[model samples]
Target: MKKITTRLATMDDIDQLADMFDAYRQFYELAPDLALSRQFIRDRMLGSESVLILAEDEEGASAGFCQLYPTFCSLAAAPIYALYDLYVRPEARKLGAGRALLLAAEAHALRNGALRLDLTTAKTNLAAQSLYTALGWQRDDIFYAYSKTLAA
Candidate 1:
């Protein structure tokens, strides 16, 4: 097993995080947009609107990252964290980085008094689903998700 460590990402990590983030978006069938990826990450980190947990090996090379958004779970009337994005580089898979990232994210949320952490994934993404299940993340069978885009 490899020794994977995770920490809250800082501005110093923006470049590496953007590179992996671009790959992650492309994996989901989105077009590659390096500029957009960089700016989005920069905005999030600069504004403190999101939590980006970065994983690395002992060598300090980037392994992967997961971005978390903090929000309130109105039904529970308490703060909660939405794990919006989680990605592990293709070559870094099976190295325990993903699990480390998840564990770190959970710790961050819990330390901040969150009620629970929530996440969603495509039904076809069985690999990710498996990881989440192995980490004790339950599927939301009790509710459906819907969204609409408003034209600006």
Candidate 2:
């Protein structure tokens, strides 16, 4: 296994991040659309809508990535991060890339004075669940997460 390095992604990394992002969507059973993925990542990076972190192995191959969106916690009265996406390449599994990315995201959030960081994953993604829990991420059992689809 190679050493994993993580850093805040910038515009220069969009191409690499987009590739990883597309693969991530595929992991969720979404159709592969590199162009859409690239454009979406480009919009976020250019607009500052989220904090993106990219991970690379010792050899500098794109290993994985995690994206954190900033939002206010009304009750806590402070900002927080919604870790909306985390993905590690299949070949990079068990190499600490995911953990490194998660830690990087946490550091970014804390550095910005965030009150907490939250995320949700497919219940069937046992590997991700184990990784998250092993890294001290608490599983929420209180309120249920709800969402509504709006026409785009």
lDDT of 1 by residue, 1-152 (tens): 56889999999999999999999999899999999999999999999999999999888989999999999988889999999999998878999988999999999999999999999988899998999999999998989999898993
Model 2 per-residue lDDT tens digits across residues 1-152: 69999988989898899999999999899999999999999999889999999999999899999999999999989999999999999899899999999999989998999998999999999999999899999998988989998986
For all candidates, the clash counts are 0, 0
Kindly report the root-mean-square deviation of model 2 from the true structure over all alpha carbons: 0.9
* Candidate lDDT values, in order: 0.94, 0.93
Q: What is the Å distance of residue 57 in model 2 from its true position? A: 0.6
Clashing pairs in 2: none
Question: Model 1 off-target regions past 4 Å?
Answer: none
RMSD of each: 1.1, 0.9
